[model samples]
Structure formats: structure tokens, C-alpha cells
Target: MACAGLVGCASVAVTDDAITQRTAFALGVDRKDLTISNRVDDGTTSRYQVKTRAGRQYNCFVGGSISVLGRTVSEAICTEVGRDGATRPAVAPANCNALLKSAGKC
Candidate 1:
């Protein structure tokens, strides 16, 4: 099946620093305010569960390189995890939404 509606299916490695920073940016929060965990890697992508200081949780999927000599995370998506474990598109700030518009994900 196609990976549409899925996150982190790109053919690139996911970096901790890059993913964390991008996740925070997408959530409109500081890196220090978020706690990322439960990373599961599958060659091309990495999935992580992130919890913010305010108890908001998310499932962030990341892939692609974030280096000067490579493309910087052309595909990074984070979805909000509901209390019952269901996931939905994360609601990002206007600026962050605009930034992620090109990728068609949040």
C-alpha cells in the first residue's frame, strides 16, 4: 500500500538533533520544553513520541538529512496523539503552518 497519510517514509536517515529541532519548530515550542521518546527506526525513517511540558503529546515521524551538503528534512510530520491514543493532524501556529505547507504536512 502507498505510504500516503503516513509520516517518515522518506528514503533518508533521521537525525536526533534535526528531528527534535524540527518537531519543536513545528509545534511552536522550544526544544527544552519537549521530551522525545519511543524512537523506532526502520532503515529509512524514524518515529518518535514527544510529550511537551504542558502534557500535550505527539507522534512525530521524521526522515531525510539535515546537513549542509544534503537536503534538510524535506519530510517531517508530527501528529497530535489524543488521550485514547488516536492520532490526528497537529495544529501548528500560523507561521509554522505556512512553513509546513510546502510539505503538505504538520
Candidate 2:
């Protein structure tokens, strides 16, 4: 798993309250109408952005991840505050620019 070392990731799970608060402070998003959760796979070097609908209480994910043996390569949880006073949790894309625009480390 030497390749695993080349790629690394992390994640965090927060309550709806904490997510809302942090998202507001960081992204300036206000409105506890959404939930976000993401996982990162280092194997294929891909990230998945799991986000819930503002009107719904289910998480819908976007993005791609590396796969091996029909399984995920790496898994991580990213916690941060985004705009609108809501916490946005998404797999940080492998792309530098994409990752930078994902969310804050809050």
C-alpha cells in the first residue's frame, strides 16, 4: 500500500446545529436547511461530496473517487464552515483549485 501513502485525506461529522453555525461563520451561509458529508479515497485519488438538500433531510453526493477491487481507495471526512452560515462537508477534490474552492477547514 505504498501508493496509499502518496495520497491522504480526512473528514469530520458534526451535528446539524454545529454544521449550520460553522457554515455561517466560514461561508457566510445562513439557513439550517442542509446537511453535508463527504469521503475521500486515496487509492484512486478521488473525492465524493455528500450533501443533503435544503428542503430534504437526505444527503446527495457528487464527485468521483478512485476504486480498487470494486471498493473505495481512500476514505476521509472533511469538516468546515461554508458560506450561508451552513457547514458544508464534501470530499476535497484531487484538483488543487477544486479542493481550494470546496470549503473552509472550520
Candidate 3:
């Protein structure tokens, strides 16, 4: 019994003034760079970036800490869906059905 719907994701920050936003993994990593991914100004410290193939991206965010599994795995959400259609706007990574489901953005 999986709920078919878009997983609504939000942003999380490590500090109060820190402008760290989380983009879904599906649309974030684009081998080159994340276009639609949120970023801070020049003075601000925004080094959150990941390298992955297009279409495989989904429900991932820029965490302030390093990913333990080498790949930045976003287990920060709790949900499920039947399909995946969301993207992070960066590398246009391939979408994952399971990620979209768990991320609540399908």
C-alpha cells in the first residue's frame, strides 16, 4: 500500500544565519552543476554540492555534514509514492521511484 503523490520537501539549515537549502536528490546532482539548486551569496559559505548522473537524482538535500556512505544519502524524509517526477535542477539526475516515494515527491 503505497501513497501515490508528490513528496513535499523543505529546507534545513545548520546554523541560524546559514542559508543552506536542501534540494531533492532526483533533480540536484547533474555531473556538472545544479542550476535550480539554491545557493548563497559570494560572501556566504555554500559548498554543498554532489556529483551524480542525471535522472538518478531524487529527494536529496545539501547537508552541512559529509555523507558517510560516500554518496550523499538523504534518509531525512518519511513518505512513499508510486512514481518519480521531481528533479533538483542541477545535473538533472535520473529519478528513483523508491526515493520519490520516501521523499514524498513523485
Candidate 4:
């Protein structure tokens, strides 16, 4: 049972890493420059608070399932952080929205 719990944790870590990478790419920033400050996981879905090197922050959501074959696939939704640290998806610029749309995110 302990081993099974460890495996589950490992899988969640992998999923978080994948989502972080995808978010960095969508934001056109280096992966290393982004910091994940907070995360919440609810079964197959997860949400994150990512801060960029420039101090800009975002709220990111990722959801998907792992297949029996151990393959993981997920979709991500991200929005800029407002002055009060709230997620402001409507404030996203056209170019950013286009990029997110192309990546099947947002």
C-alpha cells in the first residue's frame, strides 16, 4: 500500500512537470524562469499558480487522465493574474489568447 501511494505521488509529479513545460511554451518563456508557487490537485484535474521571471503571475489549470498503458495526456488553461492577484482571463491580449487557443489551452 505504501508503494502504491508513492507511485501515485510520482505520477502527479510527472503530470505537474508536463503542465509546467506546456505552460512555459504557451507563454513564450523559458521553463526555468517560471516558478510554481501553489498547486491544487483534485483527482485528474489540477490547478497552479505560476510566477514568471518578470514578476508576472498566472493561474493555470491542467486536466487529463493516465491510460492503462501509462500514457498521460492533458489539457491546460491559463490566465493572467490581476493587480489583486485574481485570475483575469478576460484581460489576456489577443496574441496571447491566440497562442493559447492554438495550443488548445486557455
**RMSD to the hidden true structure, all candidates:** 7.2, 12.3, 13.6, 5.2
Per-residue CA lDDT of model 3 for 31-78, tens digit only, reads 244323333312212333332344232232233322333323232221
lDDT of 4 by residue, 1-106 (tens): 1224223432353466787787887677898998986777766567788898999888877765544456464545678878985556623455556766676444
In order, candidate lDDTs are: 0.71, 0.36, 0.30, 0.66
The TM-score obtained by model 4 is 0.66
- Once fitted onto the true fold, the runs of candidate 1 whose alpha carbons sit more than 4 angstroms away are 1-12, 65-72, 92-106
Residue by residue across 1-106, what tens digits does model 1's lDDT show? 2343333334444667777888888888898999999888664567889999999988888766434454556345788888887765686555456656766554
Considering every candidate listed, which one attains the maximal TM-score?
A: 4
Across 1-106, the per-residue lDDT of candidate 2 in tens digits comes to 3334322321222233433444334333354544554534343333434333443222222222323433222223334446565664443344336446654421
Q: Best candidate per lDDT, number?
A: 1
User: Which ranking of candidates, highest lDDT first?
Assistant: 1, 4, 2, 3
Pick by TM-score: 2 or 3, better one = 2
Cα error, candidate 2, residue 93 (Å): 22
Using all chains and alpha carbons, the TM-scores for the candidates as numbered come to 0.65, 0.23, 0.22, 0.66
- For model 1, name the residue pairs that clash: none
Error of 3 at 70 (Å): 12
